[model samples]
Target: MQLQTPHLTLVLISLLSLNCGSWAQSAFTIDSVKLTLLPGNSVESGTKVTLRCDVKVSHSFPQLSHTFTFMKYNTIIYSKNSSQAMVERSFTPARRSNSGSYQCRVTIHSKEKSSNTETLTVRGLQTPLLRVESNVVNEGEKVTATCSVPEETGPLQFSFYRNQQMFMILTSNENSTNTSVEFQESGESDLHCTYRHMEFPDSSNSSNIERVLIQPVTIIPSIKVQPGLEVVEGDRVRISCDVLGHSKNGYEVFLTDRETLLMSSPSSFTHSFEVNASSSGRYVCKVETGKTEKISTAELFVAELLSRPVLSMSPQQVFQGQMLTLSCRTLNINQERITKADVKFELYKDQHPLKEGHTFNFTASQSSNGNYTCRATAKNITKESKQLIINAKVPVSPPVIRAVGQVIVGKPFQLLCESELGTLPISYTLLRYQRPFYTLTVSGPQRSAVFNISYINHADEIHSFTCQAQGGAYSRFSQALNTPVIEPVSKPELSLGFPRGQTFTEGTDVSLYCSVQQGTVPVTFFWYRVGSSRPLFTSRSSVTRGEHVIRSITRDHRGKYYCGAYNDAGQTQNSEPVTVGVNLAGWKKAVIAVICILILVLIVAILVLFLKKARTPRKRKRAVELSVKPARPKSSDPMRMSLTLDIEDNTAVNNTPGVMGRNVWSDHVSDSESDDPGREEECEKLRYTEIQPQQPNNPEEVALVVEECVIVNSELQDGTQEDPDHQTTDSVEYVQLNHCNQNPE
Candidate 1:
C-alpha cells in the first residue's frame, strides 16, 4: 500500500506541473484587425454607410473575448466587448460630419492591436438660395438679404458676395440666415450666397445669383455769394447753401468755410459777415438727409483795402553818430476807392507810437535799437506790417592783447583779445607778425576772443602776437603784445671749488658750483649729499651758474655730492654727482706721529747693545753697556733723536727730546776667535745721528733718514786702538740724512 501511495502522489504532482506549463504558454494574441467601409470610401450625402471592424485572434484557448473599438480621426466613436470576430457600426444617413479617417482597435488580455486607416469621404452639399428684401434700393441704404439651405445640417456658415466679391459672412445652426447689408456702390450688383457645414468646410455650393439695382441719391447743394467771389476788405459778404435738386424732407443745411461751420440752420441757409484776409478761403455748402450727405464748394477772395505800410531804413547797417533815416510808405493802394494821399501811415517803435506821417527821419543811436513797425488806414480799414528789428552798432575800439597766465616755453598758454567799447557780434582777428593767424567772431554777450598759443621757442617771440577788432565798417589795431617767456633750465654741471686730487681738510669751506648751459635768470640751486633727500645748502642766483658754500666743512661732508637748478619754467634739472674726501682732525694727526717716534727710539737702543757685544776680545770677559739719557729739546726741532756706542770703553750714549734714557749692561764670555782676526780694531763703530736743519727758523722743516750705514769696532784688553798687519785699509761707514719742508696750509 506504501508503494502504491508513492506512485499515485508522483502521478498527481506530474499532472499539476504539466497543467501549469500549458497555462503559462497559452497567451491570447490578436492576429489582425481590419476596418472596412460598407458603401465604399466616397459616397453622397443621405446614403447609408457602415464601418465594420474585423478582429482575428490566435490563442491556445478555444474561447477568447475581445474588446472592439471603432475610431474616426483618432476619436473612439463606438466601443463593444464581444466574443464575435466582427463588429459593425451603421450611419443611417451619412452626413458630411461622418466623413473622416476610420480605424479599429482590438484588445484582449491587456494586448491591443490597431488596423490600417481608411478614409470615408462623403461629398455633397445642398445649394443655397439668395433673396433680397427689395430689387432696387438707394445707395447707403440697408437691405435685407436671406440665404437658405433647406436640407443642410446645423452649424453652417453662409457667405454673401456682391459682384463676385465676398462682403459678409454669418454662422448659424439653422438652415436659413438673414442680415441687413448696405451697398456703397450705385449700380447693378450680382449677389449670391454660399453655405458650408462647419465640420466639412470643403463641401459647399454657391447659390443662384440675384441682381440688385442700387440707386444713388444725388442732392448737391449750391453755394452763392452776395458780394461776388472776389470782394475787398470791409465789405459785407453773404454765403448761401441751398439744394439744387430734389431732396428728402427733414434735411439739414450748413454753410462752412474750410470745414469750419459758419452757419447751420434748416430754415435759413445763408450766413453774412464782414470779409477780411482771414475769411478769404474755400466755402462749402453741405446738405444731409438720413444716411446721405452732399456737398458743394466755392472759392472766395478778399482783396486788401490798401497795401501794408513798409518801414524802411536808408542804410541797412546803422552805427552810432550816423545818419539813419526811417520812412513809412504804402506800396499799393485801391485806386478805385482811395488814392495814396487818402491812406494815412503811422510808425511805432517797440510797440509805442513814434510818429504819424509817411516818412520819419532820425539818427540811429543805442536808444534806436528796437523793433519797428508801421500801420496804414484807409476807409475804416487798418492793417499793420510785419515787425522790423533794428540794432544800432557801436564801432569797436582798439583791442588789447594780454597773456592769460605766465607764459612758459614749450607749454600751452592763452592770450585774450578784448575791446572795451564794441557791440555784439564783433569780429576779432589774432595777428602774428602783422598777419592774421586766427579770426573769431564774438557773438552774444561775450566781448573777448581767446587765442591759444601752443608753444614759444624764445622770449622775444611773444611780441609777435597782436589783436584787431572790427564792428560794422570800423576797424582798429592794437599794439604788439610783449610777454616774457621762461625757458627751462638745462642739466647743470656740478663742480667743487677745490683742485682735483686735493684732500678736504676739516674746518675748511666747500663750494658747490651748479651751472646750466641755457636757462633763465634767478635760478635756484640746491646742493645735496649722497643717500640724503634734504639739501645741504641752497642758493638763488641771477646768473647761469650758482654757488652753494658749506661753511666749516667737517668729516660729515665726506660723501658723494650733487646739485639741482630750478627756474620759472616749472622744471628742475639735476647735475652729476661729485665725490668729496675729508682729512682727519689736527689732534688725531699729532697722536699718530707721537706713537711712531716711540717705536723708533726703542729700536735704536737695542741696536747699540748689539754692537757693544760684538767688539769684545775673545780671551777677555767683556761687559756690554747701553746708556739711557733724558731727551733734551732741540732748538726749533722737537722730533730729533741721537744714539752712540763706544766699543773701546764699553760705553753707550743716547739723546732724545722729551724722553727718559736708561742704562742696560750685559756680561758676555766667549772662547771663539773673530771671523776677521787680522782686521783693524778701530775700523767700525755704531752711531745713530741726526742731521741739523738748514733753516732752523722754518717750522715746516723736518729731518728724515735717507741712507743707512753699519760700523764694527774691535778693541784689545789693553785699550789700544790699532790696525792689524793683514788689514790694509780702514773700515769706515757713511750715513746720509735728508731734510724736507711741508706747508700745512
Candidate 2:
C-alpha cells in the first residue's frame, strides 16, 4: 500500500460523509497483501533488489495511504512509508549473508488497518567451486571452463580454476547457465567455477564441484631468427621458442646459437641476452608443453671474436703491374670454411674498393697504389684489419717533383712531388740538400708526396728531391722528376705591315710578319687590331699574299694592327709593333703639279691668242673637244680619251698606314667638250677649279709630280699597274690652245 499524497485525512474527509471508526477515522485499511517474484529473479551480494507489493482497495477504502516494512524471515529488514498507491521496496542484490526470506507489511490509512504481509524466498550461487564443460582439450586452443550452480532459485556467481588453482571469479547471473573461463590454448589442468545470485538482501550461493581433464596438448617449438645477425659487443640477441598454432600452451622457450643454450624460460617466452666476443655461436631451441616434452634442439655456435683480418704484402712496394699477393687473415678464427668465419674481407686501394675476397693474390697496378685496408665483415660484425700497408715500393712514383719558378730571388720554389700510382697508406719524407736542408713532410698515402721549402736558390737542381714511401714492410725512395725548368710563356713581340707605329690600309702591300726575341719553336705569327677581338692578319692567307711593291703610296684604307706568336705548347710572345703609315702626299702633289702645268699652258696660249687676236681680223671660231673611251669606242661614236694618273709607290716599305682624307675630281666637263669638237671653243675658254696644295710633310712621306698630261701609256684606268718598276715612255704634248682668248697680261 502507498500514499498518493501526504494529506490523507483531508482527502478522505472531502469524499466521505462521516467517520466509521472512532480512532482510525479517514484512514484506509488493507485486507491482505501478496508479492509474487519471477523465477531466477534475485540479487547479487552488494547489489540492489526490488520487491513488488500489490494491495487490494475497494469502496471500503475511500482514499489510501500506507507505510511498508520489508522483512527477512521473521526479522524486519527495512520500513518505509508508501509514496504511491502501490508499494515497492529496493535492496542490494543477493549475497550469502542476505540469503533469507523477504516479505513486506503495509498499513492503509484509508481502511484504517494493517494488511497481512507477503513473503519471497531469496537465494544466491555459492563460491569455491570450479568446473569445465569439455572433457578433452587441444593444444594452441582457447581453454574454456564455466562456473556452476549447486541448487538454488537465485542467480548464480562463478569462479574459474586452472591446475587446481583459482584463477578468476565471474560475476553472478540469472540462469542455471554455463559460465566459461577461457584460455588461449589448452594445457594440463583442472577447471571450475562459482555461481551466485546477482541481486540481494545481498544474498548468494555457489554451484556444485566440477573437475576438468584436458587431453594431451602437443607443443611443437618453432625456431625464430633474431634480427641483426651482425653486431658488436653489448648487442642484444633475442631468441624465442613459441608453440605453433594451438600448441602455444605448456611450452618452455630456449635461446641458443646452434646447439649451445644461452637462455631458457619455463613457458612460451622471448629470451634476450646481451652479447659480447664470448657469446658467438649457432643457436636453436626446444619446448615441453604437455604429455610429451617436445624436443626441438637447434645448434647455437658461440662466436669467439677474432682480430680483424688484415691484408699484407710480402714485398710492400713495387713497380706498376708488379706481382702482388695480398695475404689476409683474421687471427683466432676457425677458418675451415671462410663462410663460417662469418667475416668477409674487403680489398681497398686508393680509398676505393679494389675487390672483395677471402684472400688476395693479384698484380699491382698504377691505380692500385693508394690508401689500402682490409675490412673484415664478420657475422653481423665488422672489424677493420690492422694496416697491412702493401708498400708497393713504387719508388714514390719518382716524386713527380715539379719545380716552382719565379722572377723573384731567394723565394723558395716548391717542387711538388706526387705519385699517380703506388702502394697505399704511405707517408712521405722529403729530403732536399738545402736550408730546410733536412727532411720536410709532404702529403700522401700513395707513392707520391709533395715537399715545400723556402729560399731554394739552386734553380739548376732545385727539384732534386728524394721522396720515400713507407708502406707495411716495404719502403723506397724515388728519383726526382724534373719539370723541365721551363720559363713562363712571354707575350711574343710582333711587327706587322712594314714601318712601325702606323695603321694598315686595305688593298696595300701589307706584309704581316711577327718575330720574338729568342723564342722556342718556330713562332706562329698572328695579327690583330688594337681594339679587335680576334686575329685579322693570319699566316699566309689568301688575301694577304704580296710584299711591298708600291713606289709611292696612297691612303684609301687603314686600321690598327698587332701580332702574337704561338705554338702547340702555348702562346709565346707579342712582337714589337710595326705600323704602316700612308699620307697620300705623293698622290696629291702629282695631281696638283699636273693641273698647274695645264694652267700654265692655258695661260701661255691665251697670251698668244690675245696677240694673234690683235694681229688677225679677230674672227670668232668655235671648237669641239672629244674624249675617247679606253678600249675601242663604237663605230658610230668617236674614240674618246680619259686621263689616268698612276702614282708609283716605293716597293721597299711594307708597313700599313692609316688613310686620313681623300679628294674627288670629276671628268664630265672634259669628256663632254672632247666629244663635241665644236665645243672646243668653250672647252678652251673654260677655267676649272684650282687644285689644292700638297699635303703637309709627314714622316717618311714625300710628294712630287706623278704624271703630266696623264696618258694611257700603261692601260685602262681600272687596270693594274703596268710594272712595279719605273719604265720610261715617249711623251706626246697635250697642249690646250685657246682659240677664244689670246692675252699678253
Q: Candidate 1 at residue 498, lDDT?
A: 60
Worst 10 residues of 2 by lDDT: 618-627
Model 1 residue 312 CA deviation in Å:
2.2
TM-scores vs. true structure, each candidate: 0.56, 0.30
TM-score of 2: 0.30
lDDT tens per residue, model 1, 396-507: 9999899998898888899999999988788999999899999999996779999888988887889999999999889999999987778889999888866643568888
Clashes of 1: 5
lDDT of 2 by residue, 374-487 (tens): 787755566676655443444334344455553222444565545565445555566665222344344433344445566544335545556655544445566654544323
For model 1, the local distance difference test gives 0.74
Cα-lDDT of candidate 2: 0.49
